[model samples]
Target: MTRKTILSAVGLVIASFAVLTALNYATAKRLYHSLTLFNESVIVENFSNMSDIFETVEIEKTAPEHKFGQAYQPLPKTYLYKGEKRDTENFLEKTSTTALVVIRNNDIMFENYYRGTTESDRRISWSTAKSFLSAIFGVAVAEGHIASLQDPVTQYVPELKGSGYDGVSIKNVLQMSSGVRFDEDYGRFNSDINRFGRTMALGGSFDDFAASLEKEREQGEYLHYVSIDTHVLGMVLRNATGREIADYFNEKLWSQIGAEDSALYIVDSYNEPMVLGGLNLRTRDYARFGKLFLDNGQWNGKQIIPAKWVTESTTPDAPHLKPGKRDSSDINLGYGYQWWIPENADQEFMAIGIYDQYIYVNQKAGVVIVKNSANINFMDNGFESATETVEVFRSIVATL
Candidate 1:
């Protein structure tokens, strides 16, 4: 080859190398942002903007929306915390709360947004999405799509057979007692939950991640807070009904309930809804769900979810699932199918998510309170953030 031709070939190779390097840099930057999305500095923005950072499937909003009535009220000035009263507003600020909505008698009593968020922002639901899934699962059961809760989960999702989920009853999985040995400590970089987050960031299969777990104990013997158990329910729902979770959810729950806006679920590489904790919606919509359960699955005189299933899901049947501390259980709060019965309860329960998200319902008081937070200190002091938030809700209810 001539000298000029050789130089031209070298230039072409140099250009190709530069383009490859730039692409790699861009990928690395994206991966870093995904991994650090929850950092204290950016968590507030990140929580409300999850769709921009991850793959999401939209749950379309339905027409003739069920809107809330306005009866605006002020929150209580003080709330009890560890037997000491603290300023309620200060507490909210301390916890990094982004949005709060209080509803009673199907009306919005108080609503506020913080940290540059608004009513339109679709806040991440985190694990609270499990409760939403539980509602839809009830629909499947009522429609006879699922034969029985006593049946093994593998009967629906045969892919889970030979894995940790094999032979585990659908009921046990619903109750979060699947006996799967999976570490959910988000503070640990190498914990299973963090690994799962990484998998989402890198486009891995959530189904495969769940199937790779190992059984730690016998099913239904104890109460274990396994996040993956919810995902298994999603799988069972999909297989039993032969439909995608998002589509089914829209048809049965989202559309039927009259959502104000389209919500989203962060999906995996295969477009599977991360039902364990990937739902996103406005704070008011969360309260709407809480209201649905508060009214025993009725919305505007229509039976959206089976009333019997609501009763069954919120009531802990087994001793291991009862509140106020137990050797067999991992938490002091009582466990139902996918709901939480707080200690010293007076017909109250809640759906909780990581980083301080809560949809608390008080039946006796006819109250529903939704709180969304970006609390980086959520795990500090043995989760006092969550325990205290319960007290805060109670105080507000008393005032209402």
Candidate 2:
């Protein structure tokens, strides 16, 4: 070979190596960013800009957006907690709330943004996305896609056979009673939930991760808060409908809701929506969903979700699913097809997400409040923050 030709080949190889190195570095940086995403200094920004840190699928908003009537009222300045009148705005600040929107009777009573976020920012839904997934699942079932809630999930997602989800009924999974053994303590670095987070950061398949789990007990006996159960429901929805979740959800719910801006779902490596959580939307849009549920799945005089499904999914119909302290459940809150029923309920339910995200609906009071927070102290004192937040919501509704 000629000397000049050999040198040219060597230069080409060197250029390729440099390019690969740069790509590897970029990937590593992104992974690191995702790993430390919840750090106190950056969590607020991270929650609002998750699309930049992760792969996402857009749920497009249709034209003729549903606008809420505005009747701006100042939030109650004080809320009672444990017989003490605590400052309401101070509680919001201490909880690191990014946004709060209060809606009553299809009108926005109060709305505000904080922590360098705006009305346009799409805040991460976290586990509150489960309620959204549950809503669309009802649509699939109503359209004759899913035959029955009593059918075993394996009947739809055969891929889950032999996994923890095998022999688990659709109803049991919806109630988070799948008997799947999962450690959801997000504070622990080596916990299953945290490992799942890392899987997203490193571009791993959520399906594979789910299929790796083994059952801990029989299905439908106890109320365990297994987040993956909701993911399995997503798989079933996709398999039953034979359509991508985003497209189906947009057609069935998002498009019908009159959302002001396009929402997003943080996807896994294979572009699967993280139906367990990972929904992102503006706070107003979140309240719109809350309002939909408050109105028994009706929006703007049109029935979006079946009224029957709405009632069944939000009410704890079985003893095992009832709220309050119980040995059969890991949580004191009641379970209802991905919705939460708080103790001493007064026709109220909520969709709660980690780090203090909540869509609180009070049916009798005609209030729907959307609260988004980056509360680093969420796990402190065994989640007293959540209890306190719920009390705050109740107090606010009482004033209205």
Candidate 3:
């Protein structure tokens, strides 16, 4: 009687454990699916509408430039209502923004969220990730993993030999002048950039994806913006250090920069990071990165990146020519390494991303504006408005 009862009780315990496990699994799966649907339908869809609204507005005025750190001290609080309108409403009405951050003199001046974006949300950086990649390159160089910016990318990624990046120096790739015929038109579904995105999304190896491109012209002769250039940079960093880009970034920058929160790099199906545009982080953490650059790569009294490299990488000395030409009359906006230099009086530059992501750094005004958006269709329109908004913000800082 005792043996039979003991066996029966053991069987019942096992059965009960199995039932609990199955219930937990089902609950987790259901929650994940619901969150995914909300992200796509609510977050992404609302962002699309905001982008469309921004495209219709015409930015007619420019703001005056203020001296760096003069207007706000110890960071200005986020303006709840500039007038009768909420700040989020202004972005939805005037710009395609899911998140926006403004910092002056290493302090947060203004931070805002729109379309349900929040401080904890991790927004996509798009090509703004390129500038971040460039910073990693700087750290690699400083750490001696990469010999120099002048080193040819092929030296590390031998597979790129005879490809579009065959003779391209790391510096050329950083400047987006590798002379590869990469179509960056996001509106065209069949464009090369879109093809690359598809390849990334489909679990293709980034190295193989980049090697598939053919060289169209000599490196360093054109100012064409090629996203692959950054990929090549990532490849070089990987090969040179024999480490994953995410691991390298976490050790060399994120952890060292005292990032307030953990960030995730969106991974491909095979777990490879979409190094070109898949970085996601909090807005204030992004501000920390911008402030690192503003401080010449010094964080907590440590030289995180060589100050000289920061100076040269952002300085615009390279010859800017139209694509496929050695000479042109177009007054090209300045570009150095992966950073963009505005064409006006203020010496402000930015790390701009598709769909309105921006790391706008104004050295003269001591302001850094970091924004993230989902405007996959409106490129030129967004840029024009962002430029104007930056000028206006700079002007307001000056008045204060």
Candidate 4:
């Protein structure tokens, strides 16, 4: 109880924290150096294995439906990538594709698995999971839970009182134009995105980390890809609905969609769902999600998502998200509510993720393609890139 003893205890605690921080930094740097562990093997295990770093909330199983006619009919033999035509076989090999499934009008046109994966594997959706959250938001809006997309995020999530999101609207977050300063390079250990990952790994809170962000630009001024923006959106949605995300997902969309197996979401130490990219579902189930959007939020006979919400969600009306350079398409892209639009495309949008995961919806062709990969070199430019994967999806749809 002496003053000397109290000072000693405080110093010891500080020293322990410093040592743990140094160790975590070293581990992150070392892990980033290995492609096999950081990219390939970890991705394979992310689906089949996820207990060490995550606490999961189960998505209740859905009643199955005989929705698809048959699978693996035939696909385009060749596809063009980076201005060169290549065979489908080579493209899959080069991209490190783990699973590929093509669904045309509710019938499987092609399906295949590689890299020790099977049809039943509950693959992680990565950022592609953002679209799933977007879907739930749409239903929330229609039900009057979230008054409007134009509402500021802090209106519902008061915990973000004075952070970068203090003045950002839900629409800006959905469009990824929150103007928060964040570096998303997965290969960089010290980058903001990686630091966020480290926070989760070390039992830090996603919301607290997000609320700590500083403003990089005026709200809605730029179209930078800030993953934490989606987390804020999820935070608002959860607060408004007053339900666990997994339970709400089951009630509103998943259970009605006829998912063959239970889907899963990775939660943080506080048990809050990682709404930015924690969704894990089967390949066919991903296709079913795409079909829901294609149907304009209709499934079988029910309007699962609001028709108006569906239309507005895909339609990028904001000036920062229009299909033009001034609208931020120097990368040959525009963005929707939570979707991506290719340069000069007609009625086509996609859900994409890092480490090469996608749900490509070509509504014009009535086709949906779900491709998942563990490509460590996804950041590599030239032929093997996310853009080229879109090209491959386009080529396949063209052949159909």
Candidate 5:
């Protein structure tokens, strides 16, 4: 063929291929956007009707038991929030939230949704899942799967022997006093915590991800809020029970808790459940957990978790209390066995997640509050402002 003819033919082929590729890309992008919008729309619909569902969930009786667990018998009377009332802010107006459920005396008193969140939306729990893991540990101990709280973590996961977690005790890990140096600053992309998150997101094994840490301090000397510490606990659970975390949770807690719907833990690419912070569930199901704790580990009269264990784990005791600090900024909020003790008179404690997820249970008032949010960048000023909203909800429960 002539040179000019050959060149023209080659250019036409290349142009045609580029056009097809661009069309494919555009089509895929449109589909993704559509799906996301649909999901968001569903969330909004669910949130809009959540108040009715909250009203319908019977608060007078206890939840029925299943294979995994049962719900606690709800108390009869609703408590009132006598504190100062605040504005009722919608979740979407403040931040990205899918659902919020509040229960008072076993009856769902306040339930709401925003940003297309629905009762079925399985939003990420972030660090809040740590407290749930701690609950599983309690069950493991009571069932004899784990011998004792005093047992060294290394006994369960031997690979940690030469690591920073070497000398850390189970109690210390539970209380987040592992003293291992970990940068929890989520704002800095280069921080250790962020690096770890990236590794997990890229499909690294939980064990291998943990083993890459360098020892920074002696175990149990200080309270260091590190997410990896919880993963170590997950390893301990897996080693002790010879099962995956998801299986253990399903068998020991989820099924028994009388969970209304099956809840799934967000798994890594390799199918390893993100034990540190990948839990997701319906808002009602999350409230069920809070109610379970408020009932002192009893579900329909069956002691799924030992009462003593729940009391001891949630109580602000050794390794958790900072003596002589009554709301002092210098004193870290009392932390216990993966639970957060608010600086309140009634010893109100909560399970808090990043970006505003919360499960606030007040045994004194027989109230439980569960909220989920996606507040853009972590540690935004909005997070601090959100606390006021939580307090407002707490007040509303006290009045119920």
Candidate 6:
């Protein structure tokens, strides 16, 4: 072929590929809830959409931000996931991982960034923010702002009156057992949770959406993962403490936890923080929170979280919330206040989010691993399930 003819052929191939990519995006976007940033073409178009979905509450760092000590340690040559040995690069690629930070002995042992992310990027926490809200509850309880766990949530947030949360206790909401019927299907366009996302995307009131949910079962009857339960917790905190969630978070947790940077929380039309999720922070700052939990809420000679609250929040004290008792098929796990417990755990728990975000805490091993990803198919394959992700963290901690 002549030079010009060959060049023309290559251009034609490129144009065809671009057309195919656009077609894929159009189809996937029709099922918009499932169209994630993991798709290369979609991500290129919609990656910035996260910040646009909601207004943000800035958690300012008070003077003297706690800095993490650098004592870098190399990762293990290989770690096992699903009975197969894998290297670090393979694991990151498979999970669509963005950042991984391992903290051992109060130091950064291993930290890696991927997909153009840096150490300073304030990656969205997704549902992992639930754990942060749970921690904030500890502070509220300690300060006497929240009188008791058994107190009815309606006592504080009377706005939930006549709704599913009418008679639910604060603890019920914390444990995801308020028994509200919410479809948390991430793949379904019409799921209730995705509808909430759509509402937030357009500056709708989260309080109104939460209060609109009808009751399905008796409160505290059985364990069900209704995320809006966490929003109720925020309402209780807001009423009981007479403060915004962002200010409380900064005063109670962020300022003293040795966080190197301020974090951001997505807000609603009423300026209510999205406590159910929508917390964004640096990976190292996330590890700081994990380390605080591992140390029983102590950081730098200060008890940031009450030690007793730490114990109660990490253990599945409620009968139905037991790891093995609640559900079988895939979620062979228990839940605490807002934390997830692995089966047969030894003082270990995790804060997980959809799309593969994690903060795995192993108290026995003195390890806290934080992972951030944009995984679109996290729920599809058995290997990519949350259970298998725990196995990966365990293997890494074991090698350390």
Q: How many clashes would you count in candidate 4?
A: 0
TM-scores vs. true structure, each candidate? 0.94, 0.96, 0.75, 0.88, 0.76, 0.87
Q: For candidate 1, what is the lDDT?
A: 0.91
lDDT of 5 by residue, 332-392 (tens): 4567788877655374778887766788888888888887876543366534544554455
What's the lDDT for all of these models?
Answer: 0.91, 0.91, 0.67, 0.81, 0.67, 0.81
Deviation in Å, model 4, residue 257 alpha carbon = 0.2
Better of 1 and 5 by lDDT: 1
Task: Tell me model 4's lDDT, rounded to 2 decimals.
Answer: 0.81
Order the candidate numbers by TM-score, best to worst: 2, 1, 4, 6, 5, 3
lDDT of 4 by residue, 1-400 (tens): 9999999999999999999899877546434432233555466765555533355788868677547877566777888766777788887887778899998888899899988889988887889999999998889888899987789999999999788888788988998889888988888879988888766665668889999998888877678898988899889988999987888888999988888888888877788888898888888889999999888899998999987877777887777787656745234567888888876778888898887889888888999999988776788863247677778888888877
- Clash number by candidate, in order: 0, 0, 2, 0, 18, 2
Better of 1 and 3 by TM-score: 1
Give the poorly placed runs of model 1, Cα more than 4 Å off: 1-30
Candidate 4, 218: how far from true, in Å?
0.9
Off by more than 4 A, model 4: 1-42, 324-330, 382-384
Summing lDDT over every window of 10 consecutive residues in candidate 6, give the lowest-scoring window.
Answer: 44-53
lDDT of each residue in 231-344, candidate 2, tens digit only: 899999999999999999899998898899998999998999999999999999899899999999998789999999989998998888998888887577898989998888
Local lDDT at 94 for model 2: 96
TM-score of 5: 0.76
- Residue 83 local lDDT, model 1: 79
